[model samples]
Target chain A: AQTVTQSQPEMSVQEAETVTLSCTYDTSESNYYLFWYKQPPSRQMILVIRQEAYKQQNATENRFSVNFQKAAKSFSLKISDSQLGDTAMYFCAFLTTSGTYKYIFGTGTRLKVLA
Target chain B: DVKVTQSSRYLVKRTGEKVFLECVQDMDHENMFWYRQDPGLGLRLIYFSYDVKMKEKGDIPEGYSVSREKKERFSLILESASTNQTSMYLCASSARTGNSNQPQHFGDGTRLSIL
Candidate 1:
């Protein structure tokens, strides 16, 4: 079984500033994928960024990036130049390359961007 | 753009009532997923379908059943709805290729209240 943990329950960031949401997972699988998803007030889940366990380099998508430390089993999301639209609930998810490809998600971190 | 559409944005039902949540995908994805989201808990997978007529139990399948008659539609059913089942239900779909590591496209979600 795999489990993802988001220690931070809630976070707040100043507008135009940067914020980092921490995430950790316990997985025995060597080949896996890590993802960060954002759910806005509209209740739509959107993919923020993704990182493959085999890829040592972190994944970056515009203002969203991930700090993936495979050895530490840590995958954190960083939002740079945060805006009001960035205020949402963020979740960290894991999926192994084998089996049914079901995703395991963390509890989530609610981020609020302050003006 | 890949779009996942859930049948209802909001629903209210009484206990012991049979509830059906419908999901449809426009991308012809090979995989479809149903998840429930609570206040603190992140998205928890209830069921998933890999192909037409092929369904699999996810992390939490208790009190939930699913049907996949077609490749583009997956339906989640609660045989007897309870107050505990009241939550935001999300539907997602993704392409299942060689590695099956593609990001999932999600619906806006259906907020169900079981009174």
Candidate 2:
């Protein structure tokens, strides 16, 4: 069983600043995937970024990027130039390489972007 | 673009009532998932189906059942709704391939209130 952990329950950053959300996971599978998802007030879950365990390089999507340390079992999300729209609940997820398509998610971190 | 739609955005139900949550995906994804989101619990998977008529239990499958009669549709069932089940329910779909690294697409979610 894989378990994702988000130590930070709440995070706040000033507008136009940068913020990082920490995440860690425990999985015995060598091949897997890590993902960052955002949920806004509308209650819509949106994919922020994803990283493949086999790939050593981190994943970056515009202002969202991930710092994936496979050995440490850490995958953190970084949001640059944060805006008010970035205020949301962020969740980290892990997926295995097996045929199943289930995700293990962390408790989530509520991010607030201050103006 | 993948589109996952839930049948309802908000639902109020009575205790011990049978509840059904419907989800439909237009992207022809082979994998569909049902999850519940709670404040400190993150998103816990209830059930998932890899193909039509094939269902699998996730982390928290107790008190929950799922049906997948069609490829694009997945339904979550609560035999007896309880107040503890009052939470946001999320539906998601993902392509079933290891090489693709495809992230799951989610719907806006259904806020289910069981009283």
Summing lDDT over every window of 10 consecutive residues in candidate 1 chain A, give the lowest-scoring window: A95-104
lDDT of 2 by residue, B42-74 (tens): 998999998899999988999999999999999
For model 1, which pairs clash? Answer: none
DockQ scores of all models, one per candidate: 0.76, 0.69
Per-residue lDDT tens digits for candidate 2, residues A40-62, read 87868899998989999999999
Q: Model 2 misses residue A78 by how many Å?
A: 0.9
Interface DockQ of candidate 2: 0.69
> Residue by residue across B1-87, what tens digits does model 1's lDDT show?
898999999999999999999999998899899999988888888998888999989889999999999998999999999999999
Report the Cα lDDT for residue A67, model 2: 93
True-vs-predicted CA distance for residue B64, candidate 1, Å: 1.4
Most accurate candidate by TM-score: 1
Candidate 2 lands at a TM-score of 0.96
